[model samples]
Target: MHIVITGAAGFLGQRLVTRLLERGRLDDQTIRRLTLLDQIEAPVPDADGVEIVAQALDVTVPGALDEVLASGPDVIYHLAAVVSSAAEADLDLGMRVNFDATRALIEGCRQHELAATRLLMASSVAAYGGELPEVLDDMTALQPQNSYGAQKAMCELLINDYSRRGLVDGRVLRLPTIVIRPGRPNAAASSFASSILREPLNGEDAVCPVPTDLEMFVMSPGKVVEALIHGAEVPGERWAPFRAFMLPGITVSVAEMLETLREVAGDAAVARVRHEPDARVTAIVSSWPARFDTAKARRLGFEGDGNFREIIEAFVDERP
Candidate 1:
């Protein structure tokens, strides 16, 4: 089987690549070729019996995906997108990359004329917004307040319709904010979530952009990679009725995350986080529903971190 991962240089894509290499198979088929595509070439592991191809290409440029899809991937993990704040800051860039590029990839799959190909897209909880149920469920309607979420929601519909037309076997995982990402902060409004813990643990002062009381729906990177693999392996019929659903996650307040940090790394680490609110970020982050009735995800075999403590500890242990 050949697998193609777009945005393969990003945090999640890189982890997913490592996990796939470790397993050596997806949906019971041996992965013989792994194609990684992004704006810059991604790093690949040296593994026996697997051919690795990493390239730097813009998906939005005409014929960009055509060149990649010619490799004929059996499965595609679409993880590329302009993040929340960046998307909001530049409408044209967001629409070009998030909307146009995504559409091109899906259409490129259709043009492949393959019998079937699995498409696993990384959607976001940002897809839900405005007045929402205290705990969002599978049945909640999408009313995205941000450009990033709106683009993802739109792509979900496209994937569903394309799947219905027998163009591709697609599934959308509406992910919670992935916490404790290791690295310097990026433009994502949710970057603060990881910054609060990651920076402080490294002995650097970090800024808390939102109120301490603000709540967030979060998942650890380890669990999300597991969810991605599981989502790819599930049979098509099991997800036929609906191609999109939320992944399970824990609801943690800003205060709760800091408390967990204190427990894991002591008061000095917790003390490094400073409360300096940013209204723009707070608006975008707060509009998302923090609590979710993810019985559907749980029933479907997706899992999340048991608590914030595990999330922090996992970060400490696994990060390079």
Candidate 2:
């Protein structure tokens, strides 16, 4: 099987690539070639049997994906995006990269006549906003309140329509905020979710821009990668009628996360977190639903982190 991963240089992308390499197979088919694409050149992994091709390609550019798609990959993990805060900050940039690029990929697949190509995209919970139920579910309508969410929601519908038309086999996983991410924070509005815990554990000061009681549905990096893979392997018949659904995640408040940090790393680490609110960040973060009824996803065999403590422990144990 030939597979392609966009945003292969980013954190989740890198993790997915590593996991794929370790398994060396997908849907019981041996992975003969792996093409990694990113704005920057993606890292080429050491795979004895698999051919690895890393390239710097801008999907937003016209015809940029032609050469890549010409090879006719069996599966494509479209993980590239402008992210939440970054997309919200730059409307044109967000629309171009987030929505437009996705359309380009779908069209590319259609033009290449690769109807069997499985395009698994990484969507965000930001897809929900404004008036919302206390607990969202797969049947909830998308009412995005932010530019980033709007862009993703648009892509979700486009992919669904295209899938229904038999142009492409697509699956959209609406992900919760991924917490305890490693390295320095980026522009994601939820970056603080990881910062408050990650920085403190590293003995560095971190800021919490939202209220202590603010709740968020979150998944760990490991679980997100696992969900992506599982989404890819599931039979296409199982995804009928709808190609998008929320992935399962644990819901926890900021204060509870700190308590979990305290349980794992003591008060000193918790003390490093200082509250200093940012209205923009808070508005975007607060708009997303904190709880979800992911029964559909659960029935689909996708799993989430058992608790915040397990997520914290996993991060601590995996950190160098």
Candidate 3:
């Protein structure tokens, strides 16, 4: 099987690539070629007998999707996006990259392949917004309050339409905020969720931009990857009516997260996090639903982290 991964340079994308390489197969088919495409070339895993191609190119550029899809990939994992804060700050850039690029990818898949290609898109919980239920569920309507969320909602609709038209076999996994992310923080407003734990354990002070009691729905990197793969492998008949849905996650307040960090890594590690609130970050995160009824995803075999302590321990154990 030939597979393509956009945003291959990103934190989650990179890890997904590594995990697929370790497994060496997908849906009982041997992965003969793996194409990793991003704005910058990401590291390639050392998997013997699997041909790896790493390309750096802007997905919005003319013919970019055509070039990436030239191999007629059997499956595509579309993880590229302008994150929450960045997308809200730059409307034109976000629309071009997130919306336009996604449309182009779908068109490329339709035109280039003789058969319907399997597409697994990485969506965000940002797709939910104002006037939400105390707990969101499969029946919950999308009411995006930010540009990032609006774009994802739009993409999900388009993916569903394309699937109905038999253009591509698409699956959209609306993921929760992944906590205890490795490496330094980036532009995401939710970056603090990971930084507060990651930086502290690494002996560096980190800022908590939101209030201590602010709640968030979160999952671990491992579980998110597992959900992604499961979304890819599951039979199409299993997804009725729509191909998009939210994944399961744990809802925890910031204070509880800190306590878990302290229990797993010590009080010194917890002390390294200092609260310095940012209104803009707070506005975006506060608008998102912190609890979800993901029974549909759970029934389909998607999983979340067991607890915040397990998430903390996993981050520390896997730290580079």
Candidate 4:
């Protein structure tokens, strides 16, 4: 299979590329070729037997998608997007990068391979909005409260339509706040969950923007990769040709997250955390739903780690 990963230099993107190699998909016997694209120059992690050529190109530029799709990869993992905070702060840039850029990818794929290709979109819980209802089922309607959420919801719709028209096979996974994320804190409001743990582990201070009681959903990069690969391999007939649905994950409160970190990393790591809430951040977080029925995804056999403790352990194993 020819596989291409956009945003190939980002934290999760790099990890996914590594994971794919570990899965032995990069071996020349299994993969025909591997292409990596990113906004800035990036080093391709050493993958034995895999032919990987990378380029630094801003995807927003015209004709960029066509260049990336020239080889017509069997599967395209579209993970490039502006963070939630950035989208909220800069509406125009958000629409340009997060929305328009993605549309370009879809259109490019449509123009190149038609019905022969598949796309896996990395969406977020942010796609949900405005004080999550008591319960969010697959049938729930989307009412995004932030520019980022609104952008993702609209993209899901376009992806579904593109699939229906046989432009490409598209599957959407509403990712949980991938816990144990390794990197500096990003603009994502949910970054605190990983930041509090990551910073403290390095003997550095971290901030908690939301109260301990605040609850939200989360998962690890391991599970996120699993969900994406599983979605990619699903037979086109397994479900109808076009349906963008939620991917299942676990939910926890800030207190729950910290407790799990303390248990996994001990009091020394926990001591480095500081709480300083910003009302705007709090209000945005408050509108997020902490849990979802996820019956559809669960029934489909997609899920995350059993507990946050496991998530914390994974973080330690990777970062420490």
Candidate 5:
């Protein structure tokens, strides 16, 4: 299998690459080549048999993916995007990178005649908003309230249509807010989700921009990468009629996350978190439904973290 991963430089992207390399296969086929694409050069892993190709190119530019597509990748993980807050801050950049680049990549697959190439995209729960039910299910409608969500919702529909037309075998995973991401925060409105736990555990000060009671559906980085691989491996017959659904996640409030941190690390770690509200962050995150009925994902063999404490413990155990 020739697998390609965009946004290969990001946290999730890097983890996915490492996991894939460790397994050395996907869809039960041996991975012979792994192509990593990002706006900046992605790290080239030292693999024994696999041909590793790393390229730094902007997907928004015309024909940017043509060369990569010409190589005929059997599987593609579309993880690149202008994240939530960044997209909301700049509409054009969001549309170009999120929506347009995705469309072009789909078209590139079609133009190259790579029929039924397994293309799995990382979408967000932000795709749901505006008068939502107490708990969201697979059948819930997408009524995005932010630019990033709107763009992702658009791509979901496009990929589904293209899949129906037999242009590609596509799957979209509506990811929950990924928690306890390592390293410094990025521009995502939900960056605080990771920051609160990540910084405090490191004995550094962190800010909570939303109310302690504000709830969010969150998944750990490890489970997310697992779901991406599982989504790709599931047969297309099962995904017919609809190709997108939310991944299972635990719903927890900011206070709960801090409490878990306190249990795992110490009271001092929790004390490092300061409650400083940011209206913009609150508005965007609060609009998303925190609770979900992910029966569909569960039935499809996807699993989530047991609880916030388990998530924190896993991060602590794994962090270098």
Candidate 6:
């Protein structure tokens, strides 16, 4: 099967591509080609048996996806987005890139009869909004507080609608804040989860945007890819329960993360973190769902999460 990954250069995208290469297809020669399209060109992984192509793709612009769908990939992972913080800052750009661009691609594929391609859109936990609860059901109504969350919520509806109309076979997995991301910081508000560990490893002090008590729904990069893969492979009838599932890791407060840091990297590493909470940051963080009962994900064979300590240790190992 030929596979296409949009935002293939981004954090989760890059990692998922590596996972795909390492774990070859179950069906022989099923995934012999991979096309990665992103605004910034992704480094196509070199493998003996797979053909990989990396291209410059701007999903927000006109005529971008038209040329892409012409190749008719068997599966498409539409993972591109501007992220939460930036989306909140620039409403128009956020709506265009995060919301409109995604819808456009869905419509484009539908019109060209390419919607049969399995589409795995990387939606976010941001889709759930207002005050969070201890547990969120698969059928919970999306009450997004911010524009980014609202946009994600909107896309989920579209994804379901297109699927119902038989225009596409798709699933939207609302991802938790991914931890242990490598390289530079991103526009995602959750980028701080990794930044706190990353900068400290580089011997630089990192700023904490919220109080140490702030809590968040977190997941490892390993788990993020697993969710994506599972969403793609589930049987169609069993997929309705998975149209949207919260893929979250261990829920913990900022204080718990810092404590874990100290246990793994020592008090000095923990000391490198300084706090100066921004009100806007607090409001945004507070509004997000920090914990969830991932019963649906568990029943579907998803795994990868524990204490924040394990997460911090994993982050240290993955990045170093």
TM-score computed on alpha carbons, candidate 3? 0.96
In candidate 3, which residue ranges exceed 4 Å CA deviation?
A: none
Candidate 6: tens digits of C-alpha lDDT, residues 1-320 = 78889999987888889988887872244578898999989998788789999998789998798876888877889999887888889999999998899899889879879756788888787788754456767667788888888998888888888887778887788888887778777666666777888778777888888888888888888878987877778754566733667765678888887887777888888789888777876777777887677777777677757677777777767764
Candidate 1 structure quality by residue, lDDT tens digits, 188-302: 7889999999999888999998999999999999999999999988876678677999999999999999999999899999989988989988987888899999877888888
Writing each residue's lDDT as its tens digit, candidate 4 over 1-320 gives 88888888887778778777788653233765668889986677777778887888888888887866877788888888888888988999999988999999998987786576878888888888764568788877888888998999999999988888878888788887778788788777677788888898777899998889988778888888888777777755544543666776688888888887788778877778888988877887778877788876776668778987888777677764
Model 1 CA deviation exceeding 4 Å by range:
none
Q: How accurate is candidate 4 locally (lDDT)?
A: 0.80
Clashes of each: 0, 0, 0, 0, 0, 1
Candidate 5 — which residues are off by over 4 angstroms? none
What tens-digit string does per-residue lDDT give for candidate 2 at 106-128? 99999999899999998989889
Candidate 1: residue 59 lDDT (0-100): 88
Model 6 scores a C-alpha lDDT of 0.80
Q: Decide which is better by lDDT, 2 or 6.
A: 2
lDDT for each residue of candidate 3 in 25-64, tens digit (9 for 90 to 100): 9889999899999999988878899999999989999788
The global C-alpha lDDT for each of the candidates, from Candidate 1 onward, is 0.90, 0.92, 0.88, 0.80, 0.92, 0.80
On lDDT, the candidate that comes out on top is 2
Q: Ten consecutive residues with minimal summed lDDT in candidate 4?
A: 24-33
